[model samples]
Target chain A: MESQQATQVVLASRPATARASLENFRVETTPLPVPGAGQVLLRVDTLSLDPYMRGRMNDARSYAKPAGIGEPMPGESVATVLESHSAEFVPGDVVLAQTGWRSHVAMDAAGLKKLDVDGIEASAYLGVLGMPGFTAWSGLEVIGKPKAGETLVVGAATGPVGSLVGQLAKLAGLRAVGIAGGPKKCAYLIDVLGFDAAIDHRSPNFAQELEAACPNGIDVYFENIGGAVWNAVLPLLNQYARVPVCGLMVQQSGTLQHDTSADYLAATMRAVLTRSLQIRGYINYEFTEQYFDSFLREVGTFLREGKIKHLEDVTVGLENAPQALLNMIDGRNFGKVLVQVRSNASASRS
Target chain B: MESQQATQVVLASRPATARASLENFRVETTPLPVPGAGQVLLRVDTLSLDPYMRGRMNDARSYAKPAGIGEPMPGESVATVLESHSAEFVPGDVVLAQTGWRSHVAMDAAGLKKLDVDGIEASAYLGVLGMPGFTAWSGLEVIGKPKAGETLVVGAATGPVGSLVGQLAKLAGLRAVGIAGGPKKCAYLIDVLGFDAAIDHRSPNFAQELEAACPNGIDVYFENIGGAVWNAVLPLLNQYARVPVCGLMVQQSGTLQHDTSADYLAATMRAVLTRSLQIRGYINYEFTEQYFDSFLREVGTFLREGKIKHLEDVTVGLENAPQALLNMIDGRNFGKVLVQVRSNASASRS
Candidate 1:
């Protein structure tokens, strides 16, 4: 924190295809922004890197608006309130804001969410206690509707959302089977997160392994990466299986080769009709007003008791935020990807 | 009525492909068996030809088991009880039975459901007042969950299930849009069925016309024919759209060429996630124990008051049952396809 200037990463150009590259982002520095009346000057601490950012790079219709060229890539981050012109927050207070990839931002106090920082790190809100955590909770309870005896299969098992989904399903008395890219995440899902079983999606016999892990057939599928993994889950889905489609990481991530065979739709429709499947897609905010309070109460208790465990994959600087996001999209980054702009944990604890 | 023999249409062979042909069924004759203890002799009067029966012909696992080769093709029909061996029923009673394509068969009294036939035709138990009617009701109310001022689109809009779906949507205060083949059925959908708009699926500009029809975007799509029609409905669907996949007529019918371009699934999955869509598949029977009585009460009243109307495409005699089913699957039938095995409207009206 020696410079009087603020650093930010902006969208340099839109990706020509679903796959995004480092060339699409640019880093620049400007004079530190001053807080206006009823606003606070925030110094970014931890920036959340999500796969959804890839969708924002394209000029496609999504729940949120696409990031414009020369505009800071949209994101949520934990920041320290350096200077406040409002009664709600004080200097050195940690708050959450949609300040994108900026090292510092002048934001209205009305939009900032203050953190409790009660034993847990302030950055925990951006991962486990924030949007990713909320997404997993809402999608599982509202759409997936897993029953105690049922089996639930979630993709991206080591990522923030899928990890929470598996742990929650296990807590709800379901047989949780997770699908991850490697043996390490797979082992972590079972050994660390208490998942009943975990299958490496990259295995040559992935489908057979998934089926073997879920001997009772999948009752709920928490869909994040939709591609070969979705196809594998389709046939094994039990009658009236519920699929809560929260993300399509494989679709947005340009690394996976597009399978040209389209009869996949026919097979999907067949399974849907024959097995009476329920596939519902949703975003977290849709359930905020309806279930957020309950979510906070329940997940907060679970977090405090150590019933749920989470992981964070942090990059070191604001300039490298773009690479962190790209890495997350390509599944090269593990856990909840984040960019640590400033590492002063004392600011929140004090 | 003088014959002492029973006639049956058995599955001669399973279709090698999705398209079933007349050769797959064979008509056979056997000596009529006397009613056994606790069984009654049922004379088939009206056999309901449903799209689901086409699924039973192939050796594919569906809601019902695959029809055994050389065994009678499974179906439900309105029948007349000729002899009773139990106190539960007597002769001259109208009943519903799963006797398939048969002129006469002995059924257990426990399985035979005695029909009132108070004002409506006993055949109505096979169409507007029966499974077709119930299918539309349960799918729309339970799964579709349409709200007032919302747009509801249905394929096969002039048939029994689709007609009732559109009428029910109209009655529920929705903008009902129908997708049918040719100008005749399209006109009938708007003029007689009271659909807010009707688009001819046969038109070269079908997608454009459909988009124009649903300016508000589709909220409930009663998916019966899932092919190009489904493709057309995908983009037009609004956020939180509900699709109750009752039948995939196009896939089973095999009249429409399989679109070799397979990007349809990607488009479907993308829309499902971006728009937060809900696509569910179900059979009417799943809701039978829960909502059947309510369905009969509401739809029965609508039928009597003329608030709802239905059409019966009848092919006389038991031998033509094969063609009746084929006609339905191929979209040649104009309305509710039924095989009138006996000309005895007087049996119920008396």
Candidate 2:
């Protein structure tokens, strides 16, 4: 194998506030790692940038450990194997790996899943056919349990997770209503994604707008953006409403603004009791073993048949990953944010 | 049959504050109600006074309607059929009825459930074998899902619902930890009811005590009391913990004092997300059709075989119900609060 250079991004410092900046990340050019016994060396093609990375930057308690200072930031990526040491694969095999923000990585063969992309784009595995899509599927199918004609509301509706959640809700015969930051995303949610209604959460009368959209009250609120959006959605939730808490993008900045006058905790608890609400928080991996296969098959078929549509806001080169992630955190990204570590032109085309 | 007068207590006024005083209730002697066609006249044997009735006193939105002014305060009671106009029940049959805070009531036979004593106390139908028992059973079985050896925590440890919840958790092979307002109730929780540990919420180090008690962390929290107790239990909850919100006894007063320094709602939601928590709110009636039979059969057997014990703080007279209910709201009652409207000697022996 050629001794190539790999560009990697690492966490330089923890963010001082709720929002992280590009300064907190450091880019470095390092020698490409070699595959050891039972390992595979891969060149990352597309790196998925997600909101959960914000939590990984903080040195606080969370479901996953914080990214260490000077260490490569954790992430999932679609890659092509440059070399292999196990019977599972050989050179030129396309696979999924947790290769972080690096152009190249040496990963255990057991941790890599070889892709079966016959007529599908390899980059699709990092978005609609991957973790974000699985998160939407499991949280909605298992937790949301959207019944026919029930109003389902989701925030960040133009993003990968929220987009798929709304689509799945619509497929299950639900009245899909979406809440996005601006009119542009809202318009896309209605026109492109085929949601029943879209409310611009940035509007001054967001709560009223949400109420107007969900005339029957929200039966399943896929909670992605917390803070004001959640407050607006709370009062509109109907009896026996299910809230699958997937993300809290608004609160990730750690400087959340809340109503000081009212006891929101008591009010929330009271609402939960009186309305018989189910508020469940989950990470996708919890259901991966049981539901990932079904999710891939169903969502994969939907993608191929044009029943579902996905958009990607791609940033070229591994060095731009920090800015891409920052853009995602600020809701500037119109769709699933991806950092192109290697040009897809060099990889086998579908 | 002799025409006898009956005594009834009615809601005189709505309380302006969190605490309800005697002035809000009035006792009066009225002519006995006669059973119309398809109705049975019942002589109230024991009236069950519960925390939920506190919510009914306020003219607020809830799952059930508020108790009407100048009308009997709504409650569940064990009664004897003094006159039966329908074939479903015969005279002298003891049955469970929503007879409210009245000594005698005329009700539809269809609404009454005839008691099957068979070595069980008829009054037990109003306490351990009735609503409170069913509330504990259904919430734990359906929502809590107490797996063997999981740590279960409950507040209001000596009350009807909390007591039964702890006992049931123990029966389900869980390590039960309880929280109560004082030392005596806490003692009762540990020594009498067989909880693994009991913490006094009144203690200055209540949170610390709870943490010490739940060494393995709380996996299933049977939330009957909300407020300070909930605050302490929140941080101690384990990952993937299930909290079944059956009641909020502490918030019943409607004047809950909470800490202002922290954004508790955001913190709670953050915890919910990071820990993958499941917080579900439900009223017992929701699960009645699905799990009530299993609850009765199992808990009934436990009661008969000395596997479970119950305590009743009985007020012997129809007129004393208001004061008894007030005592219960103040946490002065150590067990299930009940008003004995008629003596056992006057009623047919079961």
Candidate 3:
């Protein structure tokens, strides 16, 4: 299984503006390096593509260092160890690594997380049981603070974080409302994930649809797709509503809307003052040290019990990873977007 | 002394837009009413001219009902009991009441808070130890959550709420930065109030100066001014910063700034996610039931010990209340704006 050449997608150029295109990325082939002392040679199984990668691609002052040009685009993936020099792991063992958009890599054993692929699929660790799932849990429980009978609204409802958020809010006895791009995702939110109401953000009357759905007003709003959805969320937010701003997937296309009218800014500021709204932004790792184990225990159990459901939109090969990411950012993907590097046999999940 | 007639400022008309004017309020003379059973007739001493009055002047959807036309403008004041029909109060007793901008009023005994005016001046109850003080305490302690050595920035630094917030943050061992309107107020913040840094919002180099002052970045931003000040603040906010949204005084003047450029709102939203910033908006009353007693005890002690300082910009008549409020909203008044209805005899405060 150890091929001489390893394939990876590298950032060929930075975007001229917020929007990135296929030309900005290049599929490069490099000779796979052999494992050194305390290192492992791993073949990528599945790679997780998320919105934050957009921020990293640009040279700006951000939470983390920008993804460099001519380097493999930053990402995390589930992989299979082909050869190991560390005592903790052996060949055939699946693990998690920050391998970026790569098909094969040599990584120090210190950075790898051994995956327990007992009853769970390997790719599940790339999303539902990994960073996206942890993000949903931490933001909702720690920031959104979903309470029984409270109404919680999340954007990108079919995506990993939003889907898990809506489901968890429902399990906590909240009125879970979802905002998605199309009729199918909206249907999936209500029928598959048990969302109380689902509104299409792409609809002409999206704002009105959202308002009509949340008659009592929104208590907790999980902000992921910024701009129009945020404008709609502002007025409908209840007094003391908590907004856990997780990601801004739509912002990359310059779709971030703001103060279109004088009243929008005034009303938002006034509401923040009068209604006591709480708008917080965060990354997942902040709560990892404190809440990760509890999250794993709780959400892991829900997944095993079939109480929480997740969807995956897979693209085969490392070359298609860039297009899949662009589609995900454009709200064209139906669910969590993943690049399956190897074969369909490893993609099976209950 | 009981009067045969009373002078009160009433809402003549709601503002056509966000900006309220002198014409919107009218000073009217009417016959004084006798105290009914379980009620007291009170003579207003100091009328608190708060920024919230600007909000009540509008007919828009808000936290409370709009000030009714031809009715006394809503407010809280320190008044002397002139006539009483209840066993709880008698003539000469000073108390706190929701008396509006009136020289005299007939209020139910149940609605009055009997003042324990001893070493503390009665006018201090209208500013430092009253609602403004409570607003400062609750927003800073409950929401801002200031940690020692962290930097705290506040707009309207010379006003009642902001002044107290800065002082409290200082006492808690945090570095305090104040944003005020002019050189005079800026000097007062650093010289009199002990603010580590003071930047005049009116300065040509205001934003640059503010960024330079908070070299470590702002951990807590007490949002009250909401406009150019907010624009200057967004980028300077540190990761995990807590913003207590108490008021938007400058917003009434239509000074509320928004995404003037595409990157403004994008940068703000992105920072909220990456830095894990918390922007919470609230009115003082929400925490009344839970934290009021603590506020009064803590702030009362601070005021008595000379640990907290406050300033007042006073107008001599109830007729002047409208202009004073307008001035406060426009950032023209230097300190906590108050309408001195009667005389300077009751104006003495430590």
Top candidate when judged by DockQ against the true structure? 2
lDDT against the true structure, each candidate: 0.87, 0.88, 0.86
Q: Which residue pairs clash in candidate 1?
A: A262-B262
lDDT score of residue B13 within candidate 2: 99
Tens digits of lDDT, candidate 1, B139-198:
999999989999999998998899999999999999999998888999999888899999
Instruction: Give candidate 2's total backbone clashes.
Output: 2
TM-score for all predictions?
A: 0.85, 0.89, 0.82
Write candidate 2's Cα lDDT for B120-237 as tens digits. 9988988888888998888888989899989999877788888999999999899999888777888888889999999887688878988998889999999877877778889988
Q: Give the candidate order by descending TM-score.
A: 2, 1, 3
Off by over 4 Å in 2: A1-43, A51-74, A81-86, A90-92, A101-108, A254-256, A319-331, A344-350, B1-41, B52-73, B82-86, B102-106, B254-256, B344-350
What's the DockQ of model 2? 0.63
DockQ of each: 0.60, 0.63, 0.47
lDDT of 3 by residue, B1-350 (tens): 34588998889988887677788988899999778889999989988887668878777786589888899999888898988999999888999899998888888999899988876777888888888888999999999999999999998888888899999999999999999877888899999999999998767888899999999999999998886687788888888999999888765555535444444555667878878899899878889999988987888888788888888888898888888888877768876778888655544530
- The better candidate by DockQ, 1 or 3, is 1
Reference-based TM-score, model 1: 0.85
Those runs of model 3 whose alpha carbons end farther than 4 Å from true positions after fitting are: A1-45, A50-74, A79-94, A99-109, A116-118, A255-267, A315-333, A340-350, B1-45, B51-74, B79-94, B100-107, B255-264, B314-333, B339-350
Per-residue lDDT of candidate 3, residues A1-350 (tens digit): 45588899999999997678999999989998789999999989999998779889899996589989999999999998889999989998999999999988899999999987776888888789999999999999999888899999998888899999999999999999998877887898889899999998778888899999998899999999887788888888888899999888766566536554344555666778878899899888899999989998898888888899998899998899999988877768776789998656544520
* Residue B76 shift from truth in candidate 3, angstroms: 2.9
